[model samples]
Target: MKKIENLRTDYKRDQLNESSLASCPIEQFKLWFNEVLDVIIEPTAMVLSTYSQNKGVSSRVVLLKELQQDGFIFYTNYNSLKSEQIKLNPCVSLLFFWPDFQRQIRINGLVQKISHESSVNYFKKRPRKSQISAWASSQSSVIKDRFVLEALFHDFEKKFKNKTISKPPYWGGYKVVPNSIEFWQGRESRMHDRFLYTKHQNNKWIINRLSP
Candidate 1:
């Protein structure tokens, strides 16, 4: 195997400073997100971390579907392991990494299920095959083989043929309301810049510079 220690890259793309940051972290996030859309493939992909009472912490990549003023939204099977963990502990974290830009954003928050109406609205917009697949897959559950899943998909497709596919009750969206958000910008050599925004009492945010 090649020497792992030999792999390294110096980050000199950009610098982030207090003066350059938006007073509101959400505003800053929007700016970065717009930039990410231009340069990053699959910019909506984010790592969601959740804690379970029995499983400790688990993480998986989920696509961000929407960005509301109060939080971020993503949909999934409500019966999945992540959902079970969220039921046990609502606190979760989201991470967005744009390596090509040498930037990352970490959000710590509480997750809550979105309104059924909202879930239905988004579900209605999904492709017919996706809608059928959502009903077929038992996410995070053990399956005997790929054929079993394919069979289930076929069954659902036949059952919903020539009909509107409704959203499965077991699938919906969750919104992550952030309590704190951290932005990181990689710099030349080993030096990096970091800033954290913490929600304070009286509904305001306090921004602080952090050591790399």
Candidate 2:
């Protein structure tokens, strides 16, 4: 096997110059996101990091369900560990990495639960099995085994049989309102391109380029 240290990739596919970047980071994100739609699988997947005094830090991959001008949205069980951490500390970080494009985007933000109506609207759109699973799973809870989960799923399945499943009272969405967002592009010889957009007090974005 080849040595891990010997493995390297020199990115030369693209470059992000100030003149070509949008004044609004969200617009820029939409541009790059649309470009990758044809080339990347699960393009909406992002790494969400949350921290609390008790837990220190935790990270997990979560699907990005919606993106608005103000924030990004994702849903989960309210009783989950991440939710508990968020309740204690609302600040969080999000990361989106697309190796195929040698690109990454990092966002730092504050999270808040989105409106119950909005959560229910999104929840109802999910596939029936997924909706049922959301009702059955007590997220982040320890169980005896896989069979226990399977049993719960089957029980919920029958309970909701021939009926419209309602969104669980404890399952909903959170919005991460970003304060800063950084876009990173890998380049040759490790001279990468990095640009950060910070929200100013006036609610305008201040952009700055940093050394790779």
Candidate 3:
């Protein structure tokens, strides 16, 4: 390995402070997200982390589908590994990194499946091919070969030909209701700015500055 520790980048693109932050972390996330729309290739993509007693921890990048006042939303196969882990333990974490802006948002939250109606509505908006793939693939499952997958894809394509494709029962959306949200802004010399917002029992958010 080529001296991995020697590789580094000093971040000084922006600064974050208490006064500049929105009262609600969700609003603050929206502000940061909007600013990165033109700067990042996929501003809405986030790393989702889930844990199960048997499987330990798993993380993967998933595209964000929607943002609600209390939580974030994303869709996936209900039978997938991540979803299975979510069922085992609702507590999960979401991380959004925008290296170009030297900013990251980490959210610790509880995830719950959205209503089937809502999932169906979103499913209808997806491209026809994607809709078919959702039905064709058993996500996170082992398959014999690439041909097996291709064959299934072709079968589904022909099955849904010239017809409205319905959402698969195994595919849906999950919303993560955040209990805590932390925003990090990178600075020079490895010093960074961090702020955390914690939800109180009374339904108010308490903000605190964390040491870098």
lDDT, candidates in the order shown:
0.95, 0.95, 0.95
Least accurate stretch of 10 residues (summed lDDT) in model 3?
Answer: 1-10
Give the alpha carbon lDDT tens digit for every residue of 1-212 in model 1: 87999999999999998999998888899989998897879999999999977999999999999999889999999999999999999999999999999999999999999999999999999988999999999999999999999999999999998999999999999999999999999999879999999999776889999999
Clashing pairs in 1: none
- The sequence of per-residue lDDT tens digits that candidate 2 reaches over residues 119-146 is 9999989999999999779999999999
TM-scores vs. true structure, each candidate: 0.98, 0.99, 0.98
Worst 10 residues of 2 by lDDT: 135-144
Per-residue error (Å), model 3, residue 127: 0.5
How good is model 1 by TM-score? 0.98
* lDDT (10s digit) by residue, model 3, range 160-196: 8999999999999999999999999999997899999
Model 3 off-target regions past 4 Å? none
